[model samples]
Each structure stands twice: as C-alpha cells, then as structure tokens.
Target: MPQAAPMLRVENLAVTRGGLPVLEGLGFTLEAGQALVLRGPNGIGKTTLLRTLAGLQPALAGTISMPPETMAYAAHADGLKSTLTVTENLSFWAAVYGTGAIDAALDRMNLRQLADRPAHSLSAGQKRRLGLARLLVTGRPVWVLDEPTVSLDAASVALFAGAVRAHLAQGGAALMATHIDLGLSEATVLDLAPFKARPPELGGIAGSFDEAFA
Candidate 1:
C-alpha cells in the first residue's frame, strides 16, 4: 500500500468577515485529478474561502499546504487588462508563469480568432473564456476558481467544462465556487454555510457594503 498525494490540504481553517465567521475548522483534501465544488448561499463566505485559499485574503487560522507553482486562481473579476489585446494579456501571464503553451491555451478557449482584439472589446462570455484560458496557459496543477461560469453562454459553459475535464485528465486538481451546477460528473461538493461563523470584530470598516453583503 502507498500513501496518496494531496494536491491541496486544508486543516482547521477558520475565516471571518465583518466580525462573522464564514468558515470554522473546515477540513478537506483535494487529490490530483479531482474537483471539489464549494456551494452555499451568497455572503456565506464561499468567495471568501476561495480568496483565502488563493492567499488574496487573510485567514484567521488554518494550515493550507499545496505544491509549489502548481496552484492557479481565477478570480471573479477576470483580471484582464482592458487596454491590452487578448493575446498580449495571455502572453504576459505566460511569461510570468513560465508556461510555453500560449497557442494551446488560446485554442482550448477558442479565442485564437479574437487574440488581437482588446480585452475590453470582448463580450462578457468571451472575457470569461479569456480568463480561464490563462490557467490553461499557466499549466498549473491546482486551480482555485471563483464563480467561473458567471456570464458564459451555454456553449461556452460546455466548453469550460471540457477544459476542466482535460485538466483533470492531466492529473490536476480544482476547487471552485459556483452558484449554477458546473455539470462536472466527478466533482465533490462542500457546503460552506455549515462551517460559517461571524468574525469577532469588524472594526471601523465594518459598515461597508462588503460586510453588509457578508
């Protein structure tokens, strides 16, 4: 018998937003080639958990261990440069992540035709594809996606699912937060609300809409 490799491991994770604990002592492991979908009502900290895992937000307490250079995050904002052409944006991330498969990524997302167009000119769904294509270009083994299919059309959503399947085939892992079903057959689900708790003190900035939403 051999021990299994964990693409991502989270133990005793605790997170708070505006003095409310959204996650408490939540534990899970994502093995290579698997997908885990985080599900819950809005403001229950589904997005927060993803951001925390991406190291974008501070986790009050927890241990998150993952492989080096193997994790990629697809934030809700898409993170595309409005002024740059789609190809330019992908090229930039490729160099940053040191991945040499720009063409393959473009092809995967079906964005080759729009490669020369400015990101701002792309439709919402196209932008989502572009955002996802970045991960393909990076070739990271672990993906943390927040509302990945928010604006995608039916075909595009199916396309995204295909990309996910391909990624898994390559032994990658994914943790995604989505309201709609992603139609992924092999995915497992984790509900964040059960572990939800309010933070102790939201402080002066607590009155903002972010806290209100939380």
Candidate 2:
C-alpha cells in the first residue's frame, strides 16, 4: 500500500531578516489533521520561518512542498479595515478567497454579537477574534499563524483552540508561532533554537561613526 505525502514539507530551509540570516538548516513536515507549534525564545526567527512558509518572504535556501492555494497565513496584525463592520471585514476575505459562510465564521469565533459593529470600535481581543475568524472563510487546508492568541483573553483563547480543533478534525493542518499555550493537546512542538543562524564575523556593523555614536 502506498502512503500519502505530508500536507506540508519544509527541507533545509533558511530565512533572513534585515539582510542577515536568522534561521538556517531548518526542516519539518506537517501531516493533515496535525498541528505544529513553533517554540523558541524571542528573536529566534519563529515569525520569520512562518513568513517564509506563507510565501510572504523569499527563503534564503531550501524547499517548501505543498499544494498551491492550500495555505493561508495570519500574522500578528488583525488585517481588518477600521471602517468596515465585523461582518463586512469577513465578507471581504471570503470574497477574496472565493468562498462564503461569513456568519458561520463569525459564530465560530464568538463574534456573533459584534457582527454589525464597526471594526474600529472593537477591543483588542475582539479584533484578534475577528482575525482568527478570517481564517475560517479562506477554505485553505493549512494555516500559518504568527501569535494567533496575541491579545486574546482566556475565554477567547479557548474559543480559538476549539476553532483549531475543528479545523484539524476536517483534515486541516496548522503551523503557529506562539509564546502561550493554545490548548491543543495533540499539537507537536518544534523548538527553533537549534536552527538559529550564526552571527556574521567582524561584528557585521554598518553606518558611519556618527551614526554609531548616535
């Protein structure tokens, strides 16, 4: 019998930020219905790795294998329009992804009561909930999230966890960079410290003496 390939595969991937290598020689494979949590100290390139996997930035080297149009990314920012209503913001993403079911998405994120409220009026937690809701409408199989729980309260974190479980139950996968627990017991943890890039020689300094002193 033949086995299916992993939903997402990253091989010897390297990524750089600000023209300096931050992560290198990294690799991982995510099977469907599974979640992988990226764990490491601050400035260890977890976000950079997620961005590279999301195709938002070019990888310094290596390969990422996945079906086209199967990955969706959510960053720290909510990416909502202040002038748009909650439902409207979700609707916009649904339209862009050529999908529907905005109401269901809102409900999943516990935003049903705030559906008609303007995005600008929502609190930090509400905005984060809205951002997570956007993922539901994308219909993408793989989620690349950077700090998905950043501004969410305890109850909202539980809500987000439920959403993630539901996604996995439907054969979806997620790769997330988060400092706090997302309450997904089945999730695998990947500590990125081992993959940190070595600092450049000669101090890798730039700018003139005046700028340095300043």
Candidate 3:
C-alpha cells in the first residue's frame, strides 16, 4: 500500500497563558491514517495545546505547519450558536468547509432527528454530538478535537469511536484531548501533565510523562 502524507507537524512548540508558560519545547507529528490522544490531568494545558493547534490560540514559540481549511477543530465549548437549529449549525459548518453533505454528517453523528431543534434546547451530550457532526461535513484531513466525548452516553461514545476508527482507516488523522478512554489500542497517547510549566523557568515538570499515557 502507498504511504500516507503527514497531516500536521509541530516543532518546538511553547505556549503561555496570562504570561505564564503552559507548554514548553513540545513537538510531535501526526500523519494521515493515525490518531494521537492528548492525555493529562486538569489544569495541565491540554486544552491550550489543542487550541494552539487549531489556530485559535497563538503559540509562544515554534511552528505549526498545516493548512487551516484542511483542518477540522471541535472545541470543548461545543461551538454552537444558541439561536440556530442543529441543522443550521451543521449546515453552516458545511458551508464553511465547502465539502460533504450536511444531512449525511448529521446522520453519521446521530443528530438527524434533532435537526430543526435549537442548539440550546438540546442536552449537553446532544450538543456535543452536533459539534462533532460539524467535522463530518468537512473534507479536512487533520482533526483537532478537545474533549470530543464530553457528555456522550455509552452508545454515543461507541458511535464516535467507530467514526474515529473509520476516519483513521481512510487516511485521515486526529489530535484529540479527551478524558474518556477511547479503547483504541493502536492510539498513541501524549500526556501533557508533566509538560506544564513552573513559575520562573519556562520549562516543563521534571521527568518523562510522554509514555505514561501511552
């Protein structure tokens, strides 16, 4: 089989919040057909890293190489417009990416029936599903997801895992920061806890936490 191309590459990345370093000297690469999970405790900068990768936050240092339109980001906030219906939200994203069909994406995320319902009227998990449905309408090869499984029930989580597996199988890549265990044995987990910086030195916590989450 032919090899897939690299989807995202981060080199010597460092980020700061409130002028305090959060990630230091971090680097990683994600290729098409693979998945990398960002794992860490709360307040450890996992979300920040995802935001940086998504281009929603600026990196204090280093380079993030990837095409913006070729990337799909599902943030922790659900990224929904309260006044819009679920269908409207998905359709809006579909228009943004200019690829795939909105209805199909909603079907994939199991939100077809809730299409006309206002975003704020849905439950937390339903809103999350709607957020993920946005990605399905995009042809992006790189996925940056933060807490992708926030409020999913057992079946919904399983559905999401299946979608992720399908994406990987199709030569797409995903960078996700999630608390839920994905059960993807082949996934590479990058723990960010130790990478949280101290007050003075912009360095990470002592020791190697890279392999802990793997």
Candidate 4:
C-alpha cells in the first residue's frame, strides 16, 4: 500500500508577534497516529508557532499545508461560557462541530463529576480540565495545543496524557507546546531553540543611539 500524507506539514515557517518575527525557518510534519511535543524554554515563541499553525494568526513567511477543517486549537483560556454548565459548554461545541454527543469527552477528561456545574463555579483546575475536554468534542484530527497542562494537577495531567494517547490510537495527530510531560511514549519531541528568529533592528534614532551607546 502507498504511504499516506502527513496530517499537518509546515515548511520554513516564520511567525511573528506584534509585527516582529519571533520564529523563522521552522518546519515539521505530524503524521496520523503520531504526537509531537514542542520543547523550548519560556519566551521561545512556541505559543506563537502553535497559533500560526492553528490559523489564529498569519505566518510571516512559509507555508502550512493540511486538509481543511482538520485542526483544533486549545490555548491558555478555557474558552468556556461562564454561565454555561460543563455539559452545556461541551454540548455547544459538539453542536458547532456537528459531532456526536459529548459523553465520551466528559468521561475522557474526568468532567462527569462537575458536568452540572456552571463553568464559573469550577475551580481553576476544573476549568482547565473542561477546556482540555473541548478537544475531544471538536472531532478534528489535528490538535494544536499551547501549554495544555496549565492549571492541571497530577491526576488530571495523567488523565490528559491518556486522552492524547487515545487520540493517536484512533489515527489522529497532535502538536502541543508544554513543559510538563504528558507521558505519551510514542510522541516525538521538537526543540524550537534552533528556530528562534534574530531580533529586529529598532527604528531610526533609537537604533542609532543604541549602536552609538555600545
């Protein structure tokens, strides 16, 4: 049988923040049944890169190729409706994605216990779990996550690791930026240090003054 194309492919990608380049010459491919952990220290532009991949922001340069509607992005915020109960929040996403019911997602993320509570009533960790649970209801094969483990406790972290593993087992793919280990043994690591962009020069007087002061 012929091989399949990657779930997500990025080539020589350059991403920017506030109109200044933050990451350049970035390239990677995520295949089905695979997960990639983006490893880099703080201020390394990992979030920017993931955002670019998710189409939240435009890439300064290079190309990203993937099937349409194939990606789901999770960021720092839970993206929840404070007035909505946990079940309602998830059901809303399911309806939006046109996927099946949210029962599996509730169980997968351990949110069943808090299902009836409004999102505003949940603790920080609880809210985070609910946010992560949104991934399951998305029904998108490619997940782009930024610091997914934030606000999660040890048990919840393990819970999330299992979720990612399950995603890959079903021929899905994930790319995430996180410091904590999600314990996906089959997941590959991609370090972003080498892809850091050079600092842009300051404008006119400030640039000249800095050069002269040095």
Candidate 5:
C-alpha cells in the first residue's frame, strides 16, 4: 500500500530570535500517530523551533508545511489565567478550539479533583497537568509542546506518557521539546545541535551582538 502524506514537514528551516539566527537547515517529517522528541542543551533554540512551527514567530528561512488548524501548541509557561478555576480554564480553550468533552480531559489528567480550584492556588505540578490537559480538548492532529514535563512528578510524568500514547493511538502526532525522558518508547529523537546556526559573516549581522543572544 502507498504511504500516507506527512502530518508536518519542515525543510531547510531556519529560526531566529531578536534578528539573530539560532537554527538552520533543520528538516523533518512527522507521520500520523508518530512523535518526535527534540533534544539539545539550553540556548540551542529548541523552544524557538517550536514557536516557529506554531506560527507564533516567523522562520528566518526554509519551509514548514502543515495545516494551520491541525496544530495546537503548548509553551513552557502554562498559559493559564490565575483567577480562573481549572474547569473554567479548560472550558475556555475548548470553546476556542470548538471542542467539547472537558470532563474527559480533566479525568485523564487526574485533575478532576482540582477542577474547582483557582489556577494560582495550584502547585507547579498541578499547573503543568492543567496545561497538558488543554492538549486533549484541542481536537487538533498535531501537538507542538515545549518542556511538557517540567515540574511534573514521577506519577504525573507517567500519566502524561499515557496520554501521549492514547493520542497516538487515535492517530494524532506530537513534536515535543523536553529534557527528561517521557517514557515514550516509540517516539523518534531529533537532536537540535546538528541544526544550530553558525555565526553570520561580517556585514551580515541583523542586529547588535547583545540583541543576537537568545
């Protein structure tokens, strides 16, 4: 049988922060039900790559081919409203994404117990769980996540791994930038160091040296 087209495709992709190139010549393709883990040291532009793919920032060069509505991005920050209750926060995203079934998301993230608590009142791990829960309600095929397991406990990490597996089983894909092992045996690993951008030649600088640092 013929293979299905990729859910996301990035070719010769380059990203910049503050007008300084950070990543370049990065290429990858993700198929349905697959996951790609981005591994690199700090300041190597993992988060920048994710943001570029999510359209929050523009790529300095190259191409990214993925349907706009098919992607859902979760950043390092939980992006929660401090005053809103857990359910209300999720409900808001659900409405925005045109997806229902908030209860199922809460249950999956083990967040049903804290459903009524204000986001500011939750612990770090709780907040991360809430952020992960938003992915469930997105109903989007591709997930672009940054440091998803940060501040999560061992049990919560396992819960998140299970959620990723479930999403793959349902034919969704994920591209994640994380430092820890998420226990995903089937996910492919992509090291960002190979794509780290070289310093620009003289007279090619786009901004001041201080501004070029990401």
Candidate 6:
C-alpha cells in the first residue's frame, strides 16, 4: 500500500510577530497517531509559530498544507465563559464543532464533579482542565496546544497525559508547546531554536523590513 500523507505539513514557513519575523524556514510534518512536542527556550518563538499554525495569525511566507477543519487549537488561555458551567461551556463547544457528547471529555479531564459549577467559580487548575476539555469536544484530528499544563496538580497532569495518549492511540495527531513532561513515550521533540528567524538581509533598497520582505 502507498504511504499516507501527513496529517499536518509545514514547509519553508515564515511567521512574524509585531510585523517582524520570529520564525522562518520552518518545515515539519506530523502524521496520524503521533505526537510532536515543541521544545525551545523562552522567547525563542514557539508560541508565535504555534499561533501561525493555529490560524490565529498569518504566516509571513511559505505554506501550511492540511485538510480543512482538521485542526483544533488550545492556547494558554482557558477560553472559558466565566458565567457558563463546565458542562455548559463544553456543550457550547460541542455544538459549535458539531461533535458528540461532552461526558467523555468531562471524565477525561476530571471535570465531572465540577461540571455544574460556573467557570468563574473554579480554581486556576480546574479552569485549565476545562480549557483542555474543549479539545476533546472539538473532535478534530489534530490538536495544537500551547502550554497545556499551566495550572495542574500531579494527578491532574496524569489525567491530561492519559487524554493525550488515548487521542494518539485513536490515530489522532497532536502538536504542542509544553514544558511539563506528558510522559508520552511516542512523542517526537522539535526544537525551534535552530529555526528562529534571523533579521531580513539588508539589500540597501529597503524602506522598512516588512516592506523589504513584502
């Protein structure tokens, strides 16, 4: 049988922050049933790259090749509605994504007990779990997460890791920027330090850097 294409592919991609290049010449492919952990020092452009991939921002150049609606992004923000209960928040997401029940998501993220509590009433860690649960309700094949374990206890970390493991086992792909070790034995680490963007070469004809690149 022929080899299947990657679930996500980025080739020669360049992205900017504040109108200046941050990550450039980035090329990687993520296949189904696999996980990729992005590793780099703080301020080395991991978040910017992820945001670019998540469609939160436009890439300065290059291509992101993937099937439409295959990606779901969860950022540092929990993205919860303070007035909405945990279950309600998840149900809203499910309806938006046109996915199924939130019960499994609740159990996986250990949010079942707090399902009836308003998001504003939850502690920091609880809020984060609820945010991560949004990923499950998405029902998308690829997960794009940034600092997914910001506020969590050891047990909660384990829950998050288990959720990721199960997601991969089901032929899903995840690309995440996280410092906490998920203990995913199958994950590949991609260090962005090498891919950090260098200032655009001065050609002596520039009005502005962005203009030169443009």
Q: Which numbered prediction scores highest in lDDT against the true structure? A: 5
lDDT of 1 by residue, 1-214 (tens): 1246798999988776664556777899999889999999988888878888888767767898887777899988889999999999999999999876699999989999999999999999999999999999887899999999998998899899999989988888899999888889889999887776644463211223355444
| Candidates arranged by lDDT, highest first | 5, 2, 6, 4, 1, 3
- TM-score of structure candidate 3: 0.87
Which parts of model 6 are misplaced by more than 4 Å?
A: 202-214
- C-alpha lDDT of all candidate models, in order: 0.85, 0.89, 0.81, 0.87, 0.91, 0.88
Q: Which digits, one per residue and each the tens of the lDDT, describe model 3 over residues 1-214?
A: 2565567889888876544567777888998888999988887788788877878767777898875667888877878999999988888888877764787778788998899999989999999888888878887878889889988999999888888988888788899998889888778999887666665533453323243321
Residues 1-214, candidate 2, lDDT per residue (tens digit)? 1246888999988787765678877999999998999999999998888888888877778899998999999998989999999999999999999997798898899999999999999999999999999999999999999999998899999999999999999899999999998889999999999888765563332322243322
Q: What's the distance in Å from true for residue 143, model 5?
A: 0.5
RMSD after CA superposition, every candidate: 4.4, 4.3, 6.1, 5.1, 2.7, 2.9
Candidate 2 vs candidate 3: which has greater TM-score? Answer: 2
User: Residue pairs in steric clash, candidate 2?
Assistant: none
- lDDT tens string, model 4, 1-214? 1259998999988887666677888899999988999999898899889888888878878999999999999998879999999999999999999996899999998888899999999999999999999999999999999899998999999999999998988889999999987878888999999988865553211112233322
Ordered by TM-score, highest first, the candidates read: 5, 6, 2, 4, 1, 3
Query: What's the C-alpha lDDT at position 187 in model 1?
Result: 95
For model 1, state the Cα shift of residue 136 in Å.
0.5
lDDT string, candidate 6, 1-214, tens digits? 1258999999999887766777778899999988999999998888889999989878878899999999999988878999999899999999999996899999999888999999999999999999999999999999999999888888888889899999988889999998878888889999888888775563211123555433
Off by over 4 Å in 4: 199-214
TM-score per candidate, chains pooled: 0.89, 0.91, 0.87, 0.91, 0.93, 0.92
Worst 10 residues of 5 by lDDT: 202-211
lDDT score at residue 37, model 1, on the 0-100 scale? 93
Q: Give one digit per residue, the lDDT tens place, for model 5 in 78-103.
A: 88999999999999999999997799
Superposed model 1: Cα runs more than 4 Å off: 1-3, 198-214
Model 1 lDDT, full chain set: 0.85
